[model samples]
Target: MSAATATPARTAPGATTLPVADPAATRRYAWQVLRAHRGGVAAAAVVLLAGAFAGLVPVWLVGRMVDAVASDAAPSRLWWSAAALVVALVGATALAAVARLLVARTFEHALADLRERTVHAALHAPAAHVDGAGTGDLVARVSGDVDVLRTTVSRVLPAVCGAGATILLTVGGLAGLDWRFAVAVLAAVPLQVWGVRTFGRRAGPVFRAERAAAAERTSRVLEAVAAADTIRALGTAETHVHGVEEVSHRAIDRTVAGMRVSLVLTHRLHAAELVALGAVLVAGYGLVGAGAVTVGAATTAALLVHRLFDPVGILLSQVDDLQRAQAALARVVGVLSVPAPAGADAGGAGAEGAGSPAGHATTVPDDRAAATVDVRGVSFAYDPDRPVLHDVDLRVEAGEVVALVGASGAGKSTLARLVTGTVTPTAGTVLVEGEPAGGPRASAAVAAVTQEVHVFAGTLADDLRLARPDADDARLRAALALVGADWVDDLPEGLRTAVGAGGLPLAPDRAQQVALARLALTDARVVVLDEATAEAGSDAARTLDAAARRVLAGRTALVVVHRLDQAARADRIVLLDAGRVVAAGTHDELLAGCEPYARLWSAWHRGRTS
Candidate 1:
């Protein structure tokens, strides 16, 4: 909620993250994202099956030619066999190409749809979760993870499938040549199983750790960039640089560990394949020497077994890619699973406590239009160990302006966030007109203007339209004028003037005025201003303050006041200290009854007089 960006702590070594607790469940959830293309998937599978069987024709032709040569067959017979082999190879390559193309086209469509769904889920996720994860983590999921998945599907996936098909057809060829030769290859199966299982166990956690580290590194860099100005003014660039370096080292360390695992896996797989090939040769030679099969037949059996090794080798090479995709899939699935806050799109929270006990928060009536608020027994903490707001109960009657005056970290902003339903309280409830705040229509019922008044990258009209899409140019101008921003009319394009990043430059106060104009356009009854004018210099702050007062005249507003002069005009003032309301009443009432309030007022008044 703070405008200043937060610099996350350096990620520790061996740190692993998988938001979803169960990998199997996560996979099931991920499948739903791709399920729309079941027809395409089926078509690809059919093509793959046809292509694999067609490719086996060359193997049969090779066996025929070998037998013909060993038997002193006619030259014409040998030439025919060679010609047939050429034709089979050409056809096989063409079929394989078609199969690969089909799979690629289908998966590309699925990936695009999945990405859109993931973006929707992230945007609708609870604000608490978004803030907790930080910008870097979310960006990695949508950008890095999605890109990796795309590469896996496009390249590694077809390779894996083709390898499996080749291996199966080769095994069948060996069985047809001589069943004894096939048994030699089968004997090495147990070793292969053991190696794969061992490698999978070692590799899974390392892959997860690697993904998490990359995200942490990205977050560190972004945090440093966002806080560059603060670091320069405070001379903490060296400190920030050190933090980024530590996280980078941790990420590299995880990657190095994964490489080591891959090496071990590769060596073990090769050893198993070599051992099986040696057994096949020995068995084939024995059968020939005993006259159980001809030399040509033995040669054919050995060739098929050796051919099996190439595809099996290729299959093993893709294990690392598959593991990476698996980890990425789990993360994407985890994020998509976060449930959207109830009534987030609607004006109020859904039926009060649908499954909640009868004594839970009551629902506000749909007809209520007053700007009243009820924060009952509300307590909150970003970190549970350190509470920010403690069992604070408060109310602002319709049309009343309550000033919340407090020192920094006194839970002023947190209280305001809860009131606007931008954040949920850890304990108790906050309601606007009896509807739980932060409901589907929460933003429409209780709007906020925080210190970070963003003018989104778009035309001035686009920014204003965010508050009320149906508002016209006349309405936009009227709103701007209400906030004392007459200079908007002086811009080259007026309401159409470009603002925000790379657009027309706006002085901080002017941008804030744009924010107020947007707020003026909202139909939200309750308005919470959390030091919204704190960005202005003293001279501008007075002008902004006057403008704010004019705009808030008939609205129910909860202003987190930084200036005592603002508090002087409040219908009532709630003084917060260490997260509790120590006193409440008018300026004279507080000065007479509250020592802290009197001292704060006296200190401020003397400073102003001097």
Candidate 2:
């Protein structure tokens, strides 16, 4: 929860690690994703190998044709060899296309599986984890980084494999023709491989820095956009713009540096390749002149040498691509490595071992009725050194409403999160109907309505079904009615009306009502209303307050209210100050006994009347 627990160690100099898709884990996850396309992967590999073989056949045929011509072979044999060369070329081209299509399809299937898992993890990770991980970083991982991986897997890997196999085959063809020429041509490989390795190790870290810089720039840009209004209102637009500019400039500098390294490496390799080709040509001519090799054999060696180095050059050039992919993979693996939230076992013994306490049990007239909540000595913090709540103790009996009153940052919301199971306490425990609060099973008994109510882009019915996926139309309507969201029926499409993004935008009050409707649909026995009515106006607040009381009827409720008038209506009121409970009693009792409560009540009355 404390800033995503710091990113994994930086692999790039002067750049902090960005959570890109994890390469090792992504590769492993990709295989899992690819398991659904095992047949396609196999088929694609076969087609690719066949294409590579065909490509090699052309090189071999050309070498043979060269030998035939040099030896002044019969015209008929020459024509046949030329024809075979043409056929091999055509066959390889055709097979290459087929292999490409197969690989693309397989890659897409794998990408689908990865995207699904990433989205699932993002949604189901604990609130602390999600909140600590910025939205921009996650978006970049999902959209940008994932796309990079998909491209490499679909295009680069297959090409590297096919090209490499063809290059090897071509070299073998040269070797078969004349050993002396083959040896001369093969001498270039060790030099090229060594050069690639030297450049690759240096280039890998540079490319990684370039990628992290890009991610950092992206996160800053997103932050700027999200806070555009605030920045403008605060007269700090220049400051935000400057921050973005700095990040972007850093990214550009890193990218330029990476490219410069690649350019220098390429030039060095090109010089070596040119020298190798020149030596091959000179050696072949000398050997033919000395009668150590026939003219046809010399010509064959010349042609095959070019073929051999073509893939080598290509492989060396793509070292940059490989570096980028590897960096992206590391970022991805970092995210996947975050341990699953505590008490998240959905299978095996842990699920069966879950239990509750006896003190918090509530007798239900019906199985569908609500439960009590018990909190004892709960302490928590986003940072251990700065505790947000210390030894917070509170309880909500069945059918009782408790209101928490506090100034901003006084740990009211932190307590709500603890009770709702969005965050676990650093010490002590929370119990729902005597059950130890852990995981969704315990969370299912608690619902929290916070200041920000997210209305996902979907039909009204789609949004409502999030809380109760199995709920029928009647049940959905009932939940909506309970929250006074019956106005939904008046919309153009009723239950099917679009409600987010490009769809009809709901006023804040209406959005809060929709959230309450979701809470009503949930199986939660204890509802925590944290500033649920803060976004609504006086009239809307009155309507929402009425709806809340009706929907929460006979259910335990913890209301964190800013408006002390509202707190006065609760069956009991608890005052929190600097992360500790200062007082607890009925509103009248607090006014008579607690100075903080009396002062807060006076402020609320004055504000209401004013």
Using TM-score as the measure, the top candidate is: 2
Clash-forming residue pairs, model 1? 343-439, 343-440, 344-440, 345-440, 346-440, 346-441, 347-441
Query: In model 1, what is the error at residue 561, expressed in angstroms?
Result: 3.3
Clashes of 2: 13
lDDT of 1 by residue, 524-579 (tens): 56677878777434867876787788767677889988778889888999999999
lDDT of 2: 0.73
TM-score of each: 0.81, 0.87
How many clashes (backbone atoms < 3 Å, residues ≥3 apart in a chain or on different chains) does model 1 have? 7
Candidate 2 RMSD to the real structure: 5.4
lDDT at position 395, candidate 1? 89
